[model samples]
Target: MAQLIDSLRADGICIIVVTHDMDLVKALDARLVYLIPDRPGAGKVSGGPVQSPDGPDGSRPVLLPVAAMDQRDEPPRRSSRSAYIASINPAFRLIGAFLTALPLLISLDWVSATVALVLELFLLMAAGFTPLRIVRSAWPIFLGAPGSALAIILYGKAGGATYWQWGMIHVTQRSLDLALATALRILAIGIPAIITVLGIDATDLADAFSQVLHLPERFVYGGLAGLRLFSVLRDDWSALSASRRSRGLGDENRFKAFFPQAFALLVLSIRRSTTLATAMEARGFGGTEERTHARVSDVGPRDYVYLLICLAVPVAALATAALTGRISYFGN
Candidate 1:
């Protein structure tokens, strides 16, 4: 339907829709017109209401908030998106993300972690990201860093100028320093890892695994098919929840409902998996015949350059900390 409308619009045909499907309305960017009803006391009924080309629905369309009137007021959605990062081979992207995080994992020093974070921020910007976009993808890591830091601040190695103490909790200078380093390290390792892996296609990754890395196809394709079913299972879960609610079973405590809901979902999932396996077997998934991939997977110069940059970030960070005599090994 959308394609038909687009083709018609391309040939200068006016596309007018009179349905109440808000999804379709927004999808086609259709203008809405309604017959204005007469009020109780203020006014009399008028002739057929003619909608003006621009002000047909007035400044704001009187509709539900979900059916937005003006598009301009809505903010662009924040996303961890980077064409450059996604263009790299999936295998190499994962390898590079691992390498980028490896060095910071070795030492617990604020200087190195801070330097790594700063350098990674610059790289993240080069990958076409803003602060908000990174945060959008990594808010869990952001929240988790402070939580870990709080733990370290309270109960970590407590020496060198004590500040506060309460039973097992001890606040000290060393503890504070360690907490800061831990937080910085978590951020330095997490943000780039999350962003780089944001847009990797599952099929592309499976292709890379099978074609480039030569992993077992049975496992690789099985994982890929399982990943594809995630959305289907999610929809099934929603439907189950609605069914339960309509049957008056969802009014119970969530904890009490969780077991039965989970059991039903599990049963449905197993049935779907059985059907999927049967279909795949019919299509020769686990057969003896050799298989081919639709997309080619290989690395190039750009991937090498990306890997080098990933290596350089931690190298520079650790070097700075080492030169400044602040680099501290784990558990030392």
Candidate 2:
């Protein structure tokens, strides 16, 4: 991401990173951009960067000043809202679990997971993401859940009365129960995963994964390289789609044309990945035996709390059901 940003900026592209992390914003540039709210349009958004002096270490973190909309161009209020949220701190694992499963979560019936997922969504919204942005970020889970749900239903082999059979396929009372359980479990698992990930930034994720997992540096750096290419490929795919639309090719039946286009995208991605891997190898990225973390990634107190909650919920739910004599695993 740094490389990409640097490259873009070097080419005079207007790159703006709206971020809460002082460390990251400092890394990006000394000059900062501020978005101030309009008054009559109060909370109506307007923004621009006014460069301030750098930090003491000659890093010279430039502060951007904004003026009030109504005042005689008096420098706008520098609210501490952003600082407070950023200062609260977050746990790495909580971020990871959330990112990994959030999409599948949002796809699940909200009634079951609403209490948990809604809280996560609230946190993410407070972190400055819109609902649509959060949903889009989690969109991939929509594709992943059906395959998983299908696998559970097909293979779970519910031990009960058979209702229908075709070849080896069976629709038994047991199977139905298994399917429902499987679907619910998937939803429960997915929601928090999505929320955590969507809330955490990409750099934070990379740091957590590398530091917590103790992943091989080669694999980590190589994967990061590949990820950079993947992002480029995503952009390229969008451009290609727009081009296709301009060429009047967007009206084609989705299933038929989508596959070919998707295949083309896969090929493009693979090609980019190949190039990236080769470049990394040439740069001796895999040569290092010992590695050090550039940034701290700790599983803090909050992560443990979140994990405990994750473990406790189903346990409490199951116990309640058992006490009520409704805890039959088979629902017989």
Candidate 3:
């Protein structure tokens, strides 16, 4: 890999490697691009020569002043409320999502599900997600909801008066009610969970899981590493498609072409994962000894407040359902 990088550099190709393995950077003698956060939403990159910590004099890497480096303009900041929500501990957000989802998941009637969906929508808006953005991001949920509801109406456990029947497909009044409830329940549970996850930074989540939640560092960091590969996999797919088109294989049957590309992708992923695992082991990633965190993942009063809100949403939904005489348990 180092030889390939060196060869590419010799050919005047810019090979950018994003990694935490400082040893590899030192070995490559690569220029460092440090991203320094200048504001809440903005960062400035400062580049400098990499220094080896294992040098005879044990010199450390130097970070040039922001003014000395080529600087970019600051990005716009989000609303304070939005920023606060985003800053909350990801572990808490995860717990909050679970709390909010429980009631909606078990809801068997339309009223409770409807109430939960409304609350989730309100929460979404409060969290600064616009209606269009929510629809765009959660389009799969929107598209699948109706289809799922239709399936449920057609083939769900039949009860009450029959509305339609054709061969194996049957629709009844009870099925209709259940279908509507199911659709609303999906929206109520899925939207907020997706939004919460999208809002979290992968690195921040890993840090929270490791430092705040006391999860195994190996597992947390491994997951983070895998998540980072998603973008790489997307680019690889695009490149693979382009290569196939250039090779006159694009006109081949789509299903048949897919199998080869999928196999190639799997091979590429496995190779990358193996390389990453080796690098991580070299960096003492899976060591049994205690590891110190560079970033602190402390929970504060605001986090507690966020947790309370998470707890309150489901409680309120359930209470409202009970008052309306609409609460139906899972097996009712």
Best model per lDDT? 1
Clashes, model 1: 0
Candidate 2 has an lDDT of: 0.56
Candidate 3 residue lDDT tens string, 205-237? 898899888988888898899998788988999
Point out the higher-scoring one by lDDT: 2 or 3: 3
Q: Which digits, one per residue and each the tens of the lDDT, describe model 1 over residues 1-332? A: 87899789889999876664566665665456553323422122235343233323435343222222222233322223776786788888888899999878999999999999999998888778898888898899999999999999999999899999999999999999999999999999999898888777788789888877889887888789989888787789899999999998988999999889999999998998888788778667779887755456768899999999999999999999999999999989
> What TM-score fits each model?
0.67, 0.42, 0.65
How many clashes show up per model? 0, 16, 0
Cα lDDT for residue 291, candidate 3 = 74
Which clashing pairs does model 1 show? none
Where is model 1 more than 4 Å wrong at Cα? Answer: 1-80, 234-261
Worst 10 residues of 3 by lDDT: 68-77
Q: Order candidates by TM-score, high to low.
A: 1, 3, 2
Give me the overall lDDT of model 1.
0.82
